[model samples]
Target: MPTPATSMNEFLVSLLRVPAVAARDVDDEGRTLVSNDVTGSSQLHEVGPDGTWRRLTDLDGVAAGRYLPGRRAVIVQHDAGGNERGQLSLIDMSEDAGPDVLPPLSPLVHDPAFVHRLAGVRQDRVLYLTNRRNGVDFDLVSRELGTGVETVLYDGGGYVGEVEASPDGHWVVLTRPNAPANSMQLLLVSTLDGQVEELTAWAEHTHQSTPSWLPDSSGFVVSSNAGREFTAVVRFDLDSRAWTSLVADDEHDLVGWVSPSGEHLLVATNDDGAVGVAVHPLDGAGDPRPIDVPPGGCAALNRHPDPVWSASGRALALTFSSPVEPLYAVRYDLASGSLSALRTPGAPAFPPGLVQPESHRVPTPDGEQIPTFVFRPADGGDGSVVLVVHGGPESQSLRQWNPIVAGLVAQGHTVLVPNVRGSTGYGRRWYSLDDVRLRLDSVADLAALHDWLPSLGLDPDRAALYGGSYGGYMVLAGLAFQPARWAAGVDIVGIASLVTFLENTSDYRRSHREREYGSLAADREFLHEASPLTRVEAMRAPLFVIHGANDPRVPLSEAEQIVAALTDRGVPCELRVYADEGHGLAKKANQLDAYPAALAFLAHHLAKGDGVTGTVTNIKEDTE
Candidate 1:
């Protein structure tokens, strides 16, 4: 569970590789090892095997919780400098009564020049997938933890993105992209000889996500869009070269892990609009036994490692949020089948009547019903409002902690977040709604919300459009495409140019871009027409742009290019590029800086008579 602490939207959720359960002293330090988002200064402490957790580091950004091969503590730090670049750090908590010693493992891997993807650590060597050596692709490099000597196993061009090492570290799963349209083929690579074996053929347009190795390490499980509407679970045998489907449902299913007990496999499934965390058996059989946990909703389960076959099958930590609750971390006991809360630093639950988000559906111009989450403060039904757009165009807006919305609500403003069109969890039809040409539909749906806002007893003139990634792109679309609609906009790591965005993204995201935006080479004119960069001359609102220098998904150039254009046109715009951040902010300081910057921008533009005026040029480096 990320942070079962009553505060939802304290952070946003992403699909990353997380260990199902972490080993901690149950009697002393409790179960959770680190906070939800892997922030660097993450009060990241762990209960020693003897039952006590102590603070490990005092630096800024830290995350990517990797437990060393033989250590009882986590060993990776994310963006320690608030520069958006993650620094490798080793946290030693083996001592029962003292503060953990955390030392920087290597020079920080900052954006544009260096991007680190934590692969695996064996013996005293740490393996990382980095784009530092090659500008276009990633390379597997091994670094000795003590001496910091680095060795390249393979450059990213031949093999795929991050390599998944087998249990005994004898094999690795590599993702290979097929030509013509750039789809992916999952392959098994022999670590000793560097031999590649094709596991999944690129026969269709479908793709593969993170693949987890079974405890035996001889076989693995991958989430793929094989048969059903959503992604399905498939178990692959390395020796037999055969594959078996675990479960075929209309919803997408994520492989939590092959249980430590090997008897029950944890799976998070999106059944219709709701998500369920269930336990399934191996051997392609049995009905999925749903584990009763939480306040009746959940997603993103983090599993534990080691103790090979524990009676409890390790712990399952997940984030749960629903209509009645905000997002919080909840740990499920595999042995006792119990759920408990995990800690979050300063965030607290929204006081009752302070604000409550009501979920509803707004009809698009084409008769499509879009899901929307509206947060109204207690002061009055009428207040300044903002439309928070979610990224992905392919991603959905669930009931969770939205800092921007929550902050606005605290400042006596109402907030509206719409699932819009092309969001997931609503089936493939909804996801396909944001495909290139239909991109404007979701942007239009956001605009339509303004008309619906008044009916819900809100003010439209007090509205602003805020989003990151795809949501960032939508901010530009809403402002430039219709100049007078929004008073301000915030674009965080958003796509400004479809052509440049595709051309500049990392190899790992190449295939998914096609799945969402279509091919730039073939749809050249269409991409240019839809890109926000091409229409910057039409923008009229005050704009705020934040991007990570190392973002492989959208690239820092996206933000630079757009901000430069807006500046060239004399449009009011503020651009911030974190030196080490990628895709999203992982450091708490970055979060602290980002959230306040966004609030200040919105307040300057839309808040009633706070009266702080034009061209305020205060840009200070965040030291938090």
Candidate 2:
């Protein structure tokens, strides 16, 4: 028989068995095209109205897919070993199509050397973005499904995203990042003449959501934070080239998508971590008519399929992620106003004792109230806490499906999920706090949270830091810069050195990252001082690092250097490298291995042992 701790650990780790379903595209007959991890990796799956669930692809790694026009054939997007070099392919799903595991992927856009992003599938054509022409800048291209004729919609670009195509087939909107940091440039290109129309001045530096085009192609409905504090729904006219407000929220950001019938708008509000969804008429929404969800908080926008509505416009599909629940997809019927979960391989009736994270605003040293979520076990926390930071420095740690946070709470460990200084969703002002030379300011924000941890009954001395990508960098920074604050850390594909990362990262990413992290030519010294690797000698905490071998963004070298240096200094360090992964653990098999090991490692270091709770001091060596 295992000890109580061991049994609890095993049960928490078993939570990984909960399949995460991301339902995106819906066919004409109301069938949903989804990607789920039930088969150990994210693969294409279809959920029908009659309760029929079918897996479409059986690959060694993750895959993306969409239901084409008539469902005769489906577009498949796949890549090998977590390399971001995914290609677009087509699989026949018609009645005449013979069955052969995935129906044999017919090469649609097969260039292994370059990266291709599938824009979307329309009735007549498929649009995508590829850098195959120059290998640096992405060019928007569309291929006619019937004629198989390819046309370049726009060639002038850098970071030109391949996004949704217009319903009228005349225009396809392409996006690119512009200067001043955290803003975008949208270019509407004419499919026939290759003419382009730019929307918004890049100098505005305001973020915008997906432009939901009207069926008549007259204009688009989108949410933007231009000339305002919070993002609100506004319409952009193609004729007048002006924006007219449809809906405005005084406090929170609201994103709206026009329904398929073009009569209603599906609007969702980002109220801190909780999402409130409602439906408004296209003519003009008065008071929001709430579309009821599970109550805690609906999942973020990206969780659902684009457009977020059924082909008939009578139903909306969404994924719900709450502190007490693992992610599950739900379908909302507008006519009946009923919300139900989409059927999958296995859906569990989770126990009631699961903890719900409380939103706490921890005051930073500079008096900035950092938004943090405190998940304390209902039976009183074990005193061992883990401070979990999010990646993106641009992204927010929303109240959503986080298996790690859920597992940590299950194992009786207090988890602090903080949307530190640079996280989005708060406002534009909050996200730019750590930009350029002020990067370390965000790192200092973590120390404040650590010092304030004890007030919540969490043992500050017996705490660990955990994050991935940018958050991974934060984990390393907390250990290196505030050596006396953190007891242990787990870094997953994090940036080790700011200078080297900007230099060696993917070419397409370098310029984009430079906007926020400062340019190599301009601020090399500041970047070096800001890197966790620069203060490696100051690190004294035991660390566990996980990285995907094929990670294109942060790369494997970042993990190797920190692991090698820390271990060379005789400090306790554990490294797990997945040969078939990228930036983060995409495959369930790899996640099962890395996530469990990380939990165990943190648990051991944070266990209530005498003398283990002492603060970590810098490891000083006299090289004479």
Candidate 3:
């Protein structure tokens, strides 16, 4: 990444100032609730019916909230200084409250030491998951809105993930890891009784969605791939204990949920890197009607527990973005088939000649075709190439809006985004390829991508590796393991030593992360060999590192040690740490500072001649 300069170009500043809506919730009255960055920092905002904007929570860090069913109150999840140990709070949105701002967050579930994730909302109660019991096992708990009373619904053995509370409040369907890192099991917990039952035949690594209830509350619908490769929507009936498939595709995965009226289901199909959405009838009698939106990138759902439908179930709201556009929120009406923006994200303006993503597959050494989304510079290919890795080794690189990639293209850097092995949205087998000791195989995918870049008229030696979290780990690993291929690298909130990261990370995360990265107890030797710090001696590419001081996932020390080791070896390194961020840069001011400098660094180092290296003379660290 580039170090800081006194000023940034006008186009880059415009790119940084572009606002986006990440997620949203729609109330019964057709009002929109969103977590948008128009306020500089991401906070909760309500878009009223009359085109007026109401600021909800003015927290320094990001505030995520959702509308409670049929009520004027909302449940907000907030955290301190980006530690990610979220606490639940309620803000009164009743008529008595001022439109200027809602009341200060009323503590609903406040314990800084524990993590409380809000799962689903019902009539007068909210369901959530917490680790407050033993700090290791997560329990399913629900709280009343008026009385503030609590009930621990399910405390099964251990490892409870996200769940769906039945509409009638009688049952809750659960999804959790069933030993294997890439697998999950579907279970049902009776809210009225204490009994827990497996929802399906026992199978390891079976993937399923959170259940969507039927109108009568007898059974539910879900997308599961228990006995097949591609996902299909299956309906389970409690009376007969029979399963029936409603919607499926031979080549693509069909994921959807039933509408409030149970008349139709909004189904999304994943084809490679593009998405297609449609509405299917529950009877499986009619053809699926396609939705009219952008062809490539569209999102009908968001992070909130609320359904995308309005209270009346007549309107559907979704947020959309692509490589050429920033994230914007929109609504679709069923009867009218009309689409409108809830509120235009920021100004919706950018430099002219923004480019679209081109889908390609780079062949790997092991003969696997790695799916990649490449963005070319509008000014032609006079500059260098950058390989942007998506984090979550579990996550795929979608065709979504990215300010960094757009800015780089504007500056003449062609960006290649690849979904290597171990990325989801493909299939179960593809998702588990790099678990534990197979970790280095994914790093080898990056080298193969660089080797194949020459086919597109790009120089393999002039390429750079850029990513965050797991992708950041790839950046450092590429610079170290394949030192001759890359001219520079940029890492953000990534891991250096898997062994140290597993040991120093938050206590609640160690066991969960151990499933992805090898466990220290059994795989210590392999962990050391796969770590970038162990091979830091061979890293010669100029490197830039960015991290949040309070990141609970990847510790700040991961950044400190890697930069220190490289500097001691006389390799040029620069580090920028955001004191008030975690995981990644959250606030716009910090991003405006960090990204510009990182881009400057890439522009300098990648322009060097053949075997011309050491782009920086001295190491620089910014903690201010």
Candidate 4:
């Protein structure tokens, strides 16, 4: 048993101890290769059929690991610190040798200056996307595993998203996102001639992704929001260019993967914020059947380089978690439709009966409904509230495991996580609602959330805004734009100025971010107006800003400038900079330090009332 004063930190430590399967792939022998954080940082791990786990790589930042086509070797992607400029290394799993830098067959293919993303692995050939030739956009390239000979497949500009090679090795499917709008186009490229054909025509404000070729190679299946309000799994015929809706719903956006045999498809739908899994037959003769997944957020691991189905097409692997549980890797049997845990990692069972969030629809001033998850203290009626806004204005606030939310609730604070307009789980129209100049409407949605706090028996004046990345930007916007609302704010790796962020971010990410935040060159004035820095003089809340010095997505300057401005005005502000981290805090030690400081800051500010003001006290800088 623990008191409220120490339970938050204890819970934070326990949550950090629970390891998560970041990326997973299956070998022919049925062994599951996973990337997890069992040893402080995310590293490669191999799980046997008997549920035994073995460490593979001890690298600092192993983002993901995938078994090669032959299964004897595994290719792992890692970056220095959290910089995002990743490099792929080949590890001979059989020999238990250290990872070796994949020798480049063509000097042009492996340039140290650019980031290399493993697209797909075929028989003795590797397909990847890189921005080596052009600093801005990625071009698809293929290389021979043995000779390292490389050839450019698609040299087109724009952001090249996920790429999948056909089972028969004749064709490759790739997605190119047209940013600022949610529109993306899929391309079907022939391996023999390097010719590319547009599978989905340019439709304004539409999104298409996660393409898998049919076993016969005559067509492919993809998740598309093309003329529909929500994304649906649709099949496209290469010859006739005919599109057929395979699995669709009026409410949920469907995402799925077709089995290698092409007889069945495993689809996951974004039903509000929770994920639901179902298996559908491709013959179209029967209704789709639902698979019983534990009540939580479920993600299909079928998109990995390895086969989704076991060698016998009997079992499939997936990762799942809930508000109380951390992430786990499980295998689902097709015959009995039963899920067996492969790897269940996370904090020990939360002393049963912890706070379970309830879903609510908070109505905005414009009458648009915003879906939110509210976590109340077990004893009930905590006047203090924390609004946790999610990043990726395009992403949703799902009912997933969050340490901060759990910690806040344990300490008798009510927590609200909202998915405002421009969030994806809602339909396509809802996703595009916060694009470009209309971005502030999402901020208004936050203000609406603050206004609704009182109805839940929580004090609006005692509330704080907390978030990271884009969500961090929202926190600043809420504090500055809605000055009188919050008592304090915690912005972790958030962007303060959209213009500076777009200008200073990685070249490959600029255009895509510009699509979401508006281009610096074109929308300069409008972007400046929307920036949190522009309204620094209006901030009434005490602020705690955290950032990674190596953050490539949202540069350190964003935090520095805002903190400097707030401090210059004689406002209460604290700044924490982690030297070895990029974007968000990935290291456990860093998180332990940062999260505790954040919780303490919120507790201190919320207790003093919204009118309390003080001078800048402490600024801490940490390095690995």
User: Best candidate, lDDT-wise?
Assistant: 3
Task: List clashing residue pairs in candidate 4.
Answer: 18-346, 105-148, 179-515, 180-515
Local error of candidate 1 at residue 250 (angstroms): 1.9
Q: Judged by TM-score relative to the true structure, which candidate is superior, 1 or 2?
A: 2
Task: Give lDDT tens digits, candidate 4, residues 1-624.
Answer: 234667767866666667766436765465777767766787777777767666777766655756676657777677778888777777665554332432221122345577888887775877888887777778888888888888888887887988988777778889888643778888888888888887667555678877888888888899898889988999988789899999888988888688777888878887767787778888887878777767756454222222255544566776776787766676777778766665534435544545667989998889899989999878774589999988887788877768788877776688999998988888987888899989999999988998898788788889999999999999999988999888899999998988888988888888888888787888999999999999999986889999998898999999999998988888899999999899998888888888888887887777634465767854868868
Off by over 4 Å in 4: 96-111, 287-289, 300-307, 310-312, 344-351, 608-611
Global CA lDDT of candidate 1, please? 0.62
- Higher-TM-score candidate among 1 and 3? 3
lDDT of each: 0.62, 0.79, 0.79, 0.78
Q: Give the Å error, residue 473, model 4.
A: 0.4
Candidate 2: list runs displaced more than 4 Å.
1-3, 96-101, 285-287, 302-307, 347-352, 610-624
Model 1 Cα lDDT, one tens digit per residue, 453-512: 778777677778888888888888888787766788888888898889888887646655
Over 4 Å off, model 3: 1-8, 96-99, 157-159, 200-203, 300-307, 344-348, 608-624
Give the TM-score (vs. native) of candidate 3: 0.94
**Ranking by lDDT, best first?**
3, 2, 4, 1
List the RMSD of every prediction in angstroms. 6.4, 4.3, 2.8, 3.2
lDDT of 3 by residue, 1-624 (tens): 221333224567777788877546776566788777876788888877665777888876678877888778778988877888888888887664656646656889989998898887876999889989888788899998878899999887556665877777888888876667766678888889868888754446677874788877788888888787877888888788788888888777777878777888888777876666777878877888877768777454222222366655677766777666677676667777777675443465766667788989889878898889889876566548999998987777877778888777766778899998888778777878899889999999998999888888887778999999999999999998999889999999999999999999987788878888889999999999999999999999888899999999999999999998988888888888888888998888888888888888887777647343564433334444
lDDT of 2 by residue, 100-211 (tens): 3456568898898998888878767788888888777888888888888998888886886436577788877766787867777767778888887778666668777677
